[model samples]
Target: MGIGGGVFLGPVLLLIGFASPKNIAGICSAFVLVNSVVGLLSHSLQGRVDLSVLFFLGLVVFAGAQVGSFLGTRKFSPLLLQRIFAFILLAVSLKLGIGISG
Candidate 1:
């Protein structure tokens, strides 16, 4: 019933609440970790697991996440990070919209 927490929660928490960006990032990180675990388990139980592809993709995603989290949380100002996040969301939305239309 409540807002599903993930990428959207970070910005909402930062803008509408009193939490710092770093704290919001930490909370979002935990949500991502838990969601990933649950998703993996559900897929595996459904007999849709692909260990080989998951292994390679997980490695790439893990490396990127580490670097991204470090820079996003520690190096950038909150306003700059919010701008970057909005830009990314806009780009992804446009890409999906174009894909859906075409």
Candidate 2:
């Protein structure tokens, strides 16, 4: 599945020391939109698309994206966002490393 360029691109930019949250979010959002559309089309062609699930998931994702876009572009200070992102990554890493049953 296409996880979208946004997922990796924004963090890579940050790691390379880019400090513009607005620019990063904007670029990533665009990439995610394109990737999502292409992915959905490909899945649909293979008869694996679920319209019912997509419809509800799409709504929630749209709302979350809207909020994230606003916060990332305006409310979140760059340092705070970076720290938060790092924490999330760490949490995920630990979770994967330790396994869910632990």
Candidate 3:
């Protein structure tokens, strides 16, 4: 599952079988939420939690999520969304591969 369970699980889940895009998103969101909470608690107890940065980043994430959620459900079709997700995964994989090799 790497460092974040959802990051690993999402693609694996998609590949293992077929599911609707809505179902994939919902499941991944729930998976990430649980993983995030566990990670947060672990860091917080170790006094690694940075409140100031977290607050600012949280706001930015919230804004982006508002637009993203709207667009994902209303603006883009499922096929387009899947293609975008694939592109993002490819980009991330390439970056990671390069970083590791370098």
Candidate 4:
């Protein structure tokens, strides 16, 4: 299911009596990193990569991730983080469901 695994994983963890959100978050990050690298390598081998676009987007994402990691390390509310992740999952679901039809 590729990245869609997260959509299932978070809830399953919660349902299985895992109350620690931080552990889930850490696991998700590790999952993302491993999957993204695998995807990137596959795409690159298929000559689907545009290095310029990749560089620019990577720079933006890296900076944003640094800021987010910093904030996440601070004493913010866990509920707020969960709410934000839920919104992100919802948006991604909608986008994927609404494919362009010819």
Candidate 5:
């Protein structure tokens, strides 16, 4: 699965230079969470959701989000977080470019 919000939000948020990497990450996470909820609801209303997969995936993502939040807030430095975001943006761009080319 792909990261939904970061591709659009990350670069712009970084460019805006929020108070801290932690704050930026938190904002992105909030956006993504809201986006996911809305998507899930819309798909579910349309009778497109797979309950089994959603249950399993939700559990995994919940755990992952917790860990990532902890790490982003506690373990990584601001500079390191910035670099990580940059790298992720670069990687996503390259992947999209390659996919389009192919």
Candidate 6:
């Protein structure tokens, strides 16, 4: 399911009586970390991982995540964050569907 698993997870958590948004967010973060590690290992075993590419991507992603977290904590509304995430998901889906590449 790749990262799209979040589309399932968030709703499932809500339906299962975890109505607290903060708890859901924590669960999602943990899920992401675990999934990322698993994905990385799987790709590495298949000789699909390029360390240099992964390093640069990881650095940029980490920096962006930190900035995003700061904004989320300090000023951004939850609705805004949700909309931003939705847009990102849409764009990713479009790119994949269209077989777009850099």
Candidate 6 TM-score versus the reference: 0.65
- Write the residue-wise lDDT of candidate 2 on 4-95 in tens digits: 55556878887786857567667767887888888889989999998879889989998998888788877889788768777866775677
Q: Whose TM-score is greatest here?
A: 5
Model 3 lDDT tens row, 6-97: 65676887887667765787688778768877888889899999987998987987898788788888898989988987886787788777
- Ten-residue region with minimum lDDT total, candidate 6: 1-10
- Model 6, span 1-102: residue lDDT tens: 355386568657857977554456557767887888898899899998999788899999889878866787677777776676567657767887898834
Candidate 3: TM-score?
0.79
Encode model 1's per-residue lDDT on 12-46: one tens digit a residue.
Answer: 78789868766777788888878888888988999
Q: Candidate 5 lDDT, tens digit per residue, 1-102? A: 356655788678767875576787788888988888888898899999999798899899989999998988889898899899889878879988888623
Clashing pairs in 6: none
Q: What's the number of clashes in each of the models? A: 0, 0, 0, 0, 0, 0
Total backbone collisions, model 2:
0
Q: Per-candidate TM vs. native? A: 0.71, 0.71, 0.79, 0.74, 0.84, 0.65
Better structure of 2 and 5 per lDDT = 5
Candidate 1 stretches with Cα past 4 Å from truth are 1-4, 91-102
By TM-score rank, best first, the candidates go 5, 3, 4, 1, 2, 6
Which residues of candidate 6, in runs, are more than 4 Å off? 15-19, 82-102
Q: Please give the lDDT score at residue 25 for candidate 1.
A: 72
What pairs collide in candidate 2? Answer: none
Top lDDT: which candidate number? 5
Q: Of 3 and 4, which scores higher on lDDT? A: 3
User: Residue 17 of candidate 4: its Cα lDDT?
Assistant: 67
Candidate 2: residue 69 lDDT (0-100)? 77
> Deviation in angstroms for 33 in model 5?
0.8
Where does the lowest 10-residue lDDT sum fall in candidate 2? 1-10
The alpha-carbon lDDT assigned to residue 15 of candidate 2 equals 76
**Relative to the true structure, how large is the alpha-carbon lDDT of every model?**
0.77, 0.77, 0.78, 0.76, 0.81, 0.72
